[model samples]
Target chain A: MATGAEQAHGAAAPGMPQLDFTTFPNQIFWLVVTLVVIYLVLTRLAIPRIATVLAERRGTVANDLATAEELKLKAQEAEATYEKALADARAEAQKIVAEARAEINRDLDAANARAEAEIAARLAESETRIAAIRDTATENVRAVARETAVEVARAILPAAASDPAALVSAVDRRMEMEGGA
Target chain B: MAVEDGGGLSIKPMDQFIVKPLFRDIEPGSCMPPEIVEGCLKWYEPSNVTLWMGLGIVATLLLLVVGTRGRAIIPSRSQSMAELTYGFVHQMVEDVAGKDALKFFPYIMTLFMFILFANVLGLIPMSFTTTSHIAVTATMAIAVFVTVTAIGFVKNGAGFLKLFWVDAAPLALRPVLAVIELISYFVRPVSHSVRLAGAIMAGHAVMKVFAGFAAIALVAPLALGGMVAIYGLELLVAFIQAYVFTILTCVYLRDALHPSH
Candidate 1:
């Protein structure tokens, strides 16, 4: 009886539809659709924004670098100009100092020459005046001596001295004596 | 084994391997039965759906690969279409995954394209929806989950596990939160696969039922008109389901890659 029941519940034929997992074609189809749509969306809309933002950032950085370089160059130029100006001022000051020193030396030399010439003239004049005074004194003494000798001769020989020749001889003799001494 | 006198049909397990029941027998020796091939473990037999999917893949590849070749400052029509797709995916990745996670743009874009193409093709009367299959969708979701998980680990090493338990839960609720986190993490693949498959299956079943009605009511003009409208509506549904599935996949990937957001 069990055998008969098993035989009655036999399976269906080999050509019947079954419920196996047979959906590869469907899955592949949807996969293709998803890929295509996504590819389109990505290419068109999303990538450009990112690229733009990156490019903008790069540009800003480059601009900043350029500005910094320019400022540096300007600063260098200013420093060079300042150094040149300082050098020029120093040179001008040296030139003025040199000119003033030369002027002072010239004035000192002139003053020394003028003082020497004045001292030499005063010494020569004193020497000439002293010589003149000495000559005058000698002449006055000789005259006085001559006059006194003549006067003595005349008193000693009052009666005999009436002759002019005698008086003259006596005066001559006194002068000769005085000169020899 | 002949037909019964009462006209009853009998099915056997071995009959499932045959192709005649699923499709018309064009000619003797022309129609082939499904066979298991060695070294290529296939889960399903090749059906009309497979052929449609192959065609869709070929079409998408042609459009994407041949459409844009050289970069142009100003794009041509084909190039513009390609650019539009790239731009859309890029924005979606940026919006969902954040700027730091844009490195995964290529993978996300490819995923979206594959799913979108499969979904849209199903809208065609004779086309197949590959995403409708659980194996395909589950495989895709698993891949995404694995990749995101791997990325988190690779990026943060052991710290990636902290994504689950690092929250400041109340002292009494810490254990509860941990359980919830574990469950949600496990459920990711399940929800991801089911969402796509269920949407496709429901839409296809509805279309199939309506088509059956159209076939049966061959003599009624009013019924034919209603069938045509339903067909149009199914077409719309097919596109919408594809978009929904693709968008949701992107959202899930974003969450996985960047759990903080």
Candidate 2:
């Protein structure tokens, strides 16, 4: 019967149907068929689909990584350019400050030199005028003294006959003595 | 085989492994004509083999085919399981065999899933373990063996014979070592098949014996506890056996692909 192998066969190891040789052919046949079918399913359909998903994921990841790298490089270049521009501006500002400071100092020095020369010239002129005035005043004083002395002599000495030449020589000799002292 | 002892309790421990026909009725001499018996022996006739094998296929398709039908980026539970299985086998095949051997990934994947599902399915109550039979395991093992041999010859031609030649041994011992190696090499498929079948058959038989002892009221508690423990162990064994079989296949494939002495 078809059921004979699936059914019980009397043996020493009574319940162990695995020892039965009768049912082997059927199990083996079906196992081959089942294994082949499963293999087909995996190769033709299931595994290929899985591989596709995996490969797609890998490709997307790699592409994303490449894009990220390019963007990073671009950011770095931008940062470098910004830093360069900043440095240039700072240098230019420093140069401008230095040049303006030098120009201001030159102008200030020129103004100070001009003012000192003018002040020196004014001081020399004032000294010259004062000397001239002193000279004039000294001359006037000497002349007045001489004239007063002569008039007084003429008015006081009416009895006595005065020697004019002797008087004049005496007055001259006195003036010379005072000037020498 | 039930035996009644002095206590009058009988147990048939080996009754579970029976391979009964699922459909045909051939009760001894009741079929007076020999033609019916001859008709029943035909290979194409469906039996318990068809039922269990069909169940394994159905389970595989449900998990793989239907579960992955959506192919969602965020997988459902069954889809996750399907992906996990795919990745696990894929990594194993790639790591154990070289990347070149991934060409045979489908075959290795099929074997792993089939054996794993078959072993797990056998754990159900009153279910027949297809892997427990030598016929089925032997067939798979022999197929692997033939495939590896054919690949070795096809890829390496006469150079494949160098795998048997032991240049590492001393000149005097080379022949002796070659003979020894050849025997063991030929014995690989036999051991591969028997290892799985024997382990599964032994576990089921031991559990059956324990379950049979559960009939005795005095020892029922102890027997049930033991059965539970053994059942747990069998679950672990089921997965380990499948892993062992698959890894060994990878090793053989590596040998065939690279067959250098």
Candidate 3:
């Protein structure tokens, strides 16, 4: 079978076709053409297009990163501003609270002073009234003592009734004696 | 052709590598006469190589060109795939060939895409593997070699020869080392081309041999299993070979750009 197949295709069939010098020109020619065409396509169209796309993608990514950074800075600034306002508001609130406390304390102090003064004045007025009432009672008691002395003298001696003044003088003298004792 | 005279299974493993014209008036199973085949397989004749190579080119265009049509920053699936491929090759070129060598990115990208697609496309059953042919691989390697060499001279002029002069070596041994370096440098294209073609050809040929064993009743299962395993391995080899070729190209470009030892 091998011999018959060889005889059918002649001398070229017995050996490796790769070594066949006749086909070299055809193979090399086509290979060169193919390479040339491929080179042209890559250089002219494919490489440039792909490169541009990649470059565009990179540019877009860079732009996005830059925008993100800018926004981040803006957000940070806003936060700082918010923090400062909060701090100022806190300080102002503390100040207002302190001022309210001082005003209330001052008002309390003034009211306490006024109440103490009124209490002192009321005590003095009560003392003076007590003194006056004591004085009036003493005067009444002396008058009653004089009347009693006069009655006693009248009861003792009816003839001595015209000497009432003398009995009063005597009661006075007794009162002076009791006061000295 | 599968049956020998004694009725035993006779497999021609090399038969698949036969170059034939795609458009022929002859019947499918019957082989064309040598004269007719020779007449048709001229330098301009489109063979399986042409078809497969053209398919590879189409696949490349579909991935790199049509896939990225939207040019979306947030890429679609196909567009992302295109970008991934682009970034992969771009990074490879930059890393291996250094930053300044990026000027040759398109060329390296072309080589990588073409070979990668060709190798992968060849994995399909009944498909022709253009990369398996030394003619194809050798042409690419020679082109890389010539271009790199020219760039080296153009960029560094006489200093390009300094690549062979190892300053670190002992003075007495420098001449010997230079000779060895020169010879190895010349051998670069040969090794680069043959490595890809040989690896791919060997894997395919071995797979064919194992497939030939599938005709036997007892070993058929083993043969099929082996073919599957080898197919998977070939898929890996296909990608790896393309990567090796491209990286080697980048390494060569690096040497040209900075030719110090």
Candidate No. with top lDDT: 3
Better of 2 and 3 by TM-score: 3
lDDT of 2 by residue, B82-197 (tens): 88889998999899888999999999999998999889999998888889888889999999999999999999999888788888889999898889988988999999999999
What is candidate 3's lDDT per residue for B107-143, written digit by digit as tens? 9999998899889998897888989999999999999
- Candidate 3's docking class is acceptable
lDDT: which is higher, 1 or 2? 2
Better of 1 and 2 by TM-score: 2
What value does the TM-score of chain B take for model 2? 0.91
Q: Give candidate 1 misplaced runs (Cα > 4 Å).
A: A1-181, B1-50, B69-72, B166-168, B216-240
List per-prediction Cα lDDT, in the order shown: 0.61, 0.81, 0.87
Going through the candidates in order, what is chain B's TM-score?
Answer: 0.73, 0.91, 0.92
- Which run of 10 residues does model 2 chain A get worst, by summed lDDT? A2-11
Report the lDDT tens digits of candidate 1 across residue range A53-148: 445656878998999999999999999999999999999999999999999989989999899999999989999999999879867876676666
Tell me the tens digit of each residue's lDDT in model 1 across B1-261: 212223332222232122221243323232233553232223354455455556665655555555655344455687667666667777777886778777877767666666667677766765555666676678778877888788877776776666677467777886777688878887988888878877776666555544444434343465467668766776676656555655665676665566652
Best-to-worst TM-score order: 3, 2, 1
Superposed Cα deviation of residue B186, candidate 2 (Å)? 1.6
Residue-level lDDT of model 2, residues A46-80, one tens digit each, is 88877776676678789999999999999999999
Q: What docking class should model 2 receive?
A: incorrect
Q: What is the lDDT of residue B175 in candidate 2?
A: 90
List the DockQ of the predictions in order.
0.07, 0.21, 0.30
The residue-level lDDT of candidate 1 at A181 comes to 100
How far out, in Å, is residue A37 in model 3? 1.7
Candidate 3 chain B — worst ten consecutive residues by lDDT sum?
B26-35
